[model samples]
Target: MEIFKVEKATLSSVDDLKAYHAHIRPFVLQRLEEFRETWERGDEAVFEELVFCILTAGASALMGLRGVEALRPVLWSATAEEIAQRIHFHLYPAARAQYIVAVREVVRNELGGRLKAWIESWRGRDTRRDACVQKFKGIGYKEASHFLRNISFRGYAILDKHILRSLHAFGVIDSDRPPSTRNRYLAIEQRYLTFAHQVGIDPDELDLTLWASRTGMIVK
Candidate 1:
């Protein structure tokens, strides 16, 4: 992750953050609403979201989205080699391909090819995220949170580099270093939540706002 400065002196004020949030709130809500609608698109759409997150590891979100669009034809049946060949513009296509294939097999064989149903079976949001992290080959805490959030599950923080930097800039976190373990991740996520609450912005909205500030785009 790049260590870009956040200009805390200017952007750290909660009032300033709230002003920014007001301007972009509608777009953020629309993106989140689209996430909620993903559940209606059936397992393939949900699985595609997972693939997008998987491809995002060590890659840009736009690159991941482009890769997913390219691989949609054979996403459910492609071999790792096939997937790797199709997944362009990624830093580690082979590794991501293996992960996608492995996770797809697990879902098809063990989870009965009912990805959406299996995810819906979990009672709590955090429980669902934990299950995803444990079961999926390429997923970690951040990716699991990302997948859940993309599927409209609430309260879990993605803690991506942009988020970590934003948290540090806003004084919610002491440093931009990513949490090294699950416990640490949750702790930092709580800190982010607290900061969001204090500033009167929804955590999800604030996350997107921070992400948009860095990327100049708000996307799922």
Candidate 2:
């Protein structure tokens, strides 16, 4: 196996994000504008966004949205304990319920009893992305990336199967290993960061464009 080298890339502005998005897909400009409008209208809290991210993991956009819809009320009106209890009742496969409780505990411990403070801390700290994500018991690389992307993490890229396949098809990454391995995720992320830099777009925007394009979501 060839070891992949990590290259750090950063997107410091919205303009950079827009340019990258456009490079990835010509229609991304309108799509991103639409998503931004929806995001602004909803004005979801960071913690709420994180919960949505978790719900969306390894699922289709429509399915993810349905899960988020189910999760939203619990997030907004219920305490963490209450949310944990209710999520299990509605969300199935049993493991998802366990994940909810584990995440709640992580937030309580990591944020020192304040979800708002944790959200604020997340925005400023580069290292906190991984640390906060890893705190959730069952969250792995793809889920973590998906969660961070929802919140528009500046330097981070999401590596879903569609994006991974696209990258491999474009010769940007080699698909020689199973998707469950850490090395595969790392390699995909490294390649995506490089591609984002080359195209002058933030990784988050790149992810949005790629997902939209692959999923056939109309942007506007």
Give all candidate RMSDs, comma-separated.
4.1, 9.4
User: Candidate 1 residues 1-220, lDDT tens each?
Assistant: 1122222223567777788778777778888888888878888888889999999877778788889888999988789999999985578989999999999998889988899889988998778888999999999999999999988888778899988988898778899998889899989988998888888888888888888777667876
Task: Count the clashes in each prediction.
Answer: 0, 1
In angstroms, the error of model 2 at 163 is: 0.5
Total clashes for model 1: 0
Tens digit of per-residue lDDT, candidate 2, span 67-160: 5556676654455456545544344425554566567666666655465455446555345556665576656776666555445444565676
Model 2 regions lying over 4 Å from their true place = 1-44, 76-92, 109-113, 119-126, 176-184, 218-220
RMSD score of candidate 1 (Å): 4.1
